[model samples]
Target: MREHRGFEALGQAVALAEPPLIESSARTDVGVHRRVNEDAVFADGGVYVVADGMGGHEAGDLASAAAIEPFRALAAAHGARDYRMVEATIELARRAVDTVSLRTERGAGCTLTGVVLIEHGGIPHWYVMNVGDSRVYLHSGAELTQLTVDHSLHAELLAEGRAEAADTPRNVITRALGSGDSRHDAWLLPVHAGGASWCALTG
Candidate 1:
């Protein structure tokens, strides 16, 4: 997996073996304020995560970097072979972002998403999680599926049939890191076979 950083966005990539290293990328952006992107690799019931940060006047970069640092440390200490650890690492990122006190402005924040690769009795599986518009998609044979649902005002509107796909709210995320300390949300997704591959896309 890899993490890419930019002035306004963050990106991640993962390579799968059985899936033949299918081309996939995940990204998240907190508009002109912040962004984070993360990815994971699956093989032999293991996962790897990479988170990129992009927020803060001085703290935006710190927030993004801080979001991933703890997860990386946890992964290094405990390894991604355990699914529970994957979830823990995610929460850790959320908490890490929260711990970063905002210097000025409305506060520091970031977007995050990741995947966990696992195998149960020889069956390969994937577990996905996200907070914000960072996305996860699955492609099986000829059909592509969205594994992780987006958490944004636009998504809420889409769910209520009040908005079109092209009319989505611009970077209006309903949830994310450092948004607050009271609420936290994420998704647990399983990857299935039958010519299926997964991708996480965000705009």
Candidate 2:
């Protein structure tokens, strides 16, 4: 299996009297059965992103790479703080993936999930965005809480009591980039100094 790893830490300490240090780590592996890894990640400049390409589709890797390129570029420019910029970046990613879909003619698509550190009233906060089934989790003390909902058929089925979570196919995502649906969910929450968060792109 092909494995890729990345790590990032924000050195620009939060301007608080006692600044909070931020650190992160990410790893992705291509399954034993897969020939290539179809996941891409960007973790830098107080921004983190994970894009999981649709399996069983042509050019999955390319789709995922395209989906993350915009965010990666933005990270180089100090990342985004306004919600509008974040939304615009995602839209650009959607178009990038769509270009792959059109060129490959194999329904290329990917799930995008990410978080950006922002400031509100001089206090730090996390702005989360999600599309498809990729997830974000916040760990506080000994408890782990999911911060994003899955946009997948299995999740919908379980929510409606039409199917059991164990019986549903987890890979059936209901929304994704390049699917002509650019809509995504967003949330803003205070970032506690001692708390930690991470993003996961599950198949």
Candidate 3:
């Protein structure tokens, strides 16, 4: 809850709130060894997405892009849809990814990570999602915390203490869009006004 600051002696100090202005940006790079970049980044109208294609998949690029297509469409036209809208959008994206796999017939798939802006009771909120190894982070004050867990063998091994994740070559994802597990981990979070987001790429 926001604290009411200052004295409200002047007729209760009535003030109107302005609608949040949505903003976003994105960037991606073809990794060192891949001939084709299998990662997709999308940011628009307060919707942000990053997807990585499954390694060795022939149509990974298409899968990654397809995973974000539904949200891309929603960015241009949306209202205060709440979580219902978010669930529908993700289903759309999953279907798009499935189409890509069927058209290619290559078992194509990709990891999905994203944050969508929505309104709840006239207040802005964020709908966050993740699948496979892609992740989302929340930065508050001096702490940056991971908000999603990886749906990968490496993560599972680490979680179960079966094996150390020091070398990930032995690891493979257990979930992805259009392949393996198709479930999306989702969260509804309050959007702190005046907060910002950015893209940070490592290798």
Using TM-score, give the best candidate's number: 2
Q: Considering summed lDDT, which 10 consecutive residues are worst modelled in model 1?
A: 1-10
Q: Which lDDT value does model 1 have at 197?
A: 66
In each prediction, how many residue pairs overlap at the backbone (N, C-alpha, C within less than 3 A)?
A: 3, 0, 0
What is every candidate's alpha-carbon RMSD to the true fold? 9.3, 7.4, 8.7
* Candidates ranked by TM-score: 2, 3, 1
Q: After superposing candidate 2, which stretches have Cα over 4 Å from the reference?
A: 1-19, 78-80, 163-166
- lDDT by residue (tens digit), candidate 3, 76-170: 87455666676787778788888889887468888888777776556666777787878888766777777776788778877887746756643
Whole-model Cα lDDT of every candidate shown, in order: 0.52, 0.76, 0.72
Cα RMSD, model 3:
8.7
Record all residue pairs in model 1 with backbone atoms less than 3 Å apart, i.e. clashing. Answer: 53-64, 55-60, 56-60
Candidate 2, 97-123: lDDT as tens digits: 999999985689888898976665466
Better of 2 and 3 by lDDT: 2
TM-score of each: 0.61, 0.84, 0.81
What residue pairs clash in candidate 2, if any at all? none
For candidate 1, write residues 1-203 as lDDT tens digits.
11212111112233335542334443444455334332222222234333333232236556667666655554355433444555566667777777774564656666666566543324344556666666656666778877555667788887888847457755677666777431334333443333356555543
